[model samples]
Target: MSNLDQARVASRSTETTRAALIKAATSVFAEYGYDGGSVRLITQRAMANQAAVNYHFGGKDGLYREVLIAATRAFEENAFLDPEELDALSPEDALRRYLHQFLLPLVKRDRVSRFLRIFAWESVQPSEVFSAFIANSPPRIFRLAERVVRRFLPHDASAEAVTFAMLWLAQQPMFFVRDAERLAQPPFSLKFDEDALERLVDTLAGLSLRGLSGV
Candidate 1:
């Protein structure tokens, strides 16, 4: 092969290894979390050399960081609605629409469970990486959500109240996203097909409005 051909081959190989390492790391971290997940396990799953991670991502920490950044990116793309979309709606409509959009991430067919896994990791064993990742992520609709909620809350409403309400709203989707398998079976035996999801989202939105507005 000519020098140019050799370089092209090397580039392709590097891209392949990097992609594999990232994919493997996501599954490992989701399964074992950042602390328990090992470079060896990631590399084995990726079917790349162990040294490939060090070469591409610098180390386990770097690999884990990349994995989460990727997951968070996917989550944002699937979850957040544009704040501009709420501009034309009344506060009540905005709040209802916002809650519905927030839950949309949980309904993503492929990444919902993985995103839930990442959030669970954040809650259980947060690290500098998680903190930094959250800090740097672009403004989510949460800011708009806060504004919408504030319009209905009492004048004495504290930041804590708003945050608590948001977290409470989040739990509904989190349960469905994280516990779908169990939630699908047994005494609950709930379904989440199209009609069911719509009803659930509408119910959550209504409950959120009533609670926030003190209605």
Candidate 2:
């Protein structure tokens, strides 16, 4: 092979390896979690040797971080607004957008299942590593939510009120994914399709805004 051709081949091989590792890591981490997911199992799953983890990802912790990042990939898309754009938005508009953005992570059915199932496991039987991960890696959208929500709060908004509002909003997506069938029954028989869920964002935003604005 020519020098350039050989370099291209090497680059493709590297990309392939990294993608394999991330895919393997996602499954293994989802199955076993950070504490139980060993480097050995991950390497075996990826069909690579142990050293590949260190070479590509630095170490197991780094690999796990990448796995978490992949899990959240959907959420990160279109998650940021230019500061100027956000500053120009009215508080109600900002809160409405923020609430809609918050649920984007669960937009895909598979992503929703994996995310909820993995986190359910983590929360029920969390390890020290899980605690550290939560403590260190607050989702970026959370700060955005708080910033907009604060606009409607009194100067001395109860800290718990702010947190409570967030938790209540959080429950909507959880219920949509977790109790989907229950939601689709006789009296409450609501469509849980993507469009329906998207519409849900507007409903929630309106209800939440009224309460927050004391309308």
Candidate 3:
């Protein structure tokens, strides 16, 4: 084969290999947690050689970072939100948009939901990498919630109150969907469908506004 043809083939192979590694790592990390997952396991899952993990991702840490980056990029692209645009929207419109933007991606994409579950589990344990990730990305939904609440509520809402309300609002979707096993049992018995999710969002937004207003 010509040198140019070989180069093209090599580039394509590298890209394909990297994509497979990331996919494998995401699943492993999500199922096993960061501490439990290993490079060897991820490579085996990817159907690539044991050395492939190091070759494609440098190591487990690199693979973890890539998994996060890929998930966040998918979220940023598919979730569809702009803080400035949100600021311009009416309170109800902003709340509706924010809820859909944050929840729809996770609900529609099983991989994203799995990643989120992994993130939540890792975050509770605490680590330098997790801390840095939180510090850097933060949660846009909190700011979005606060802004929308402020638009319809008293300007003097306490930061604590706003934060609590925002956090609660953010948790509603994940808790209901991700933890559905518990939610579906006994007294809760809450079965969530698309319509139910919409109602939950609307109710949470209204509650946030009320809480912020001290009503």
Candidate 4:
């Protein structure tokens, strides 16, 4: 093999190793959380040596950051909202699109939702590490939803009204996922199938539209 060819192979191998490490770390973090997890566990899950974690990510903290970056990058790529396009859509369509973008991914990607639940739990009673993590990626969905609502709602709409609308729209998935036990009770059993998801999106959009129209 030529020297250049060998170098190319080496580079590809390194990339593969790094990707594996990130995937393993994301799962570990989702399962055990940031504070409860360790580099050793992540490396073991990846089937790579402990030295690989140190060499590739520098340490556990760095590995966690890479995991978050990878997840967010995938999220942005798959489901990003363009503020410019909001004006083109009718109020109902715009609101539906926004809610779908925010909620659909969480329902579909179970791992990401699990990781987010862990993150949310940590954020409530945060240590320094988790607090920094929350600061690094603050929730932008509420702000984005508020902006979209303002575009559709009357100028006289109060900030509190807009905020309430945003929260109401945002909580649809959380209500199901976070309250799984309650939802499983008699007459309240809710499954996250396609029909259920569509219903959720429609309900949130309808309610927000009514609120905007002062109904």
Q: Kindly provide the TM-score of model 3 when superposed on the true structure, using C-alpha atoms.
A: 0.71
Better of 1 and 2 by TM-score: 1
Per-residue lDDT tens digits of candidate 2, residues 72-127?
56446533444345558997777666655545434544543455434534644666
Q: Rank order by TM-score, top first? A: 1, 3, 4, 2
TM-score to true structure, per model: 0.74, 0.58, 0.71, 0.65
Error of 4 at 152 (Å): 5.3
Worst 10 residues of 2 by lDDT: 74-83
**Poorest lDDT segment (10 consecutive residues) of candidate 3:** 172-181
Which one wins by lDDT: 3 or 4? 3
Order the candidates by lDDT, highest first — what do you get?
A: 1, 3, 4, 2
Report lDDT (Cα) of residue 165, candidate 3. 68
Higher-lDDT candidate of 2 and 3: 3
Q: Which candidate gets the maximum lDDT versus the true structure?
A: 1
The residue-by-residue lDDT of candidate 1 on 1-215, one tens digit each, is: 99999999999999999999998877776666677778888889999988898899788878877877777677567654656667778877877776665455345545545655656555557777777876877234335556666667777877799887655654545555545666779999987766677788788777777777662
Q: What local lDDT does model 3 show for residue 88?
A: 84
Clash count in backbone of candidate 4: 0
Q: What tens digits encode model 4's per-residue C-alpha lDDT throughout 150-192?
A: 7666678787777776666555444444444456677877666
Clashes of 2: 0
